[model samples]
Target: MIKKLLELSNLETTISLRQKELLELEEKIEEKKRLLKQLSRKVRKYEEYNVAEKEAAVTVAVEAEPDSEKKVGEIARTDLVRLLESGRVPQSVIESLKDKRYSKDTFDLNFPMLREVTDMGKVDELKKDQ
Candidate 1:
């Protein structure tokens, strides 16, 4: 009877150790799953950026212009490029908009104050007004 009791106690200890190990392994698996989700989101963001770059390349080729003259849209983009350095906007959002061309007619309609100041050639006046 004494020998049987010792055997039973040893068996119980072995089972408890295995249970602890199993719990640890499950925790590790959950941590790995979280990491995988984060990595996947990053991959998707980069994929979208790649697609935008390809589209921009095609647009630049189609809208080639002489170096001496600048288009109205080009002028707006040049002025707006300051957003990239302003730190108020996200870098990713600014990068997407930096290469985009804005129509002067659209700008005038949407932002009349901006259009008026830009047209009047008063950079300081616009800044002071804003």
Candidate 2:
């Protein structure tokens, strides 16, 4: 009976050791899962940050033109060239007409004209006429 008791005690000790090992393994797995979750969250935040930065860059690019009036003036200059090319106006007359119209304040003249032309609904009218 004493021998049987010793054997039973040894078996009980072995079972306890196995249970302790299992609990340790479970704790390790839980820690790993928590770490993975934290890493995933960080990755998601980085992705969102990148997306927002790209959107802001695109917005800035869309509105990057410094002076809208200057662009319009350049367009008008090109139109004048086209009109002269089409024989609507003679080349010899064009230079004299430009000198009279522009004078010393040539650069200043067009910005305000461009602004007024844009504000006065002239662009829509011109588009319709075309």
Q: What's the TM-score of every candidate structure?
A: 0.48, 0.48
lDDT of 1 by residue, 1-130 (tens): 9999999999999999999999999999999999999999999999888778656643553354446677756744763444334554444333433332322232233223232334556665654522
What's the CA RMSD for each of the models? 11.0, 18.3
- Estimate the lDDT of model 1: 0.58
Tell me the lDDT of model 1 at 46.
Answer: 93
Ten-residue stretch with the least lDDT total in model 2: 108-117
Q: What's the lDDT for all of these models?
A: 0.58, 0.58
What is the clash tally of candidate 2?
0
Model 2 pairs whose backbones collide: none
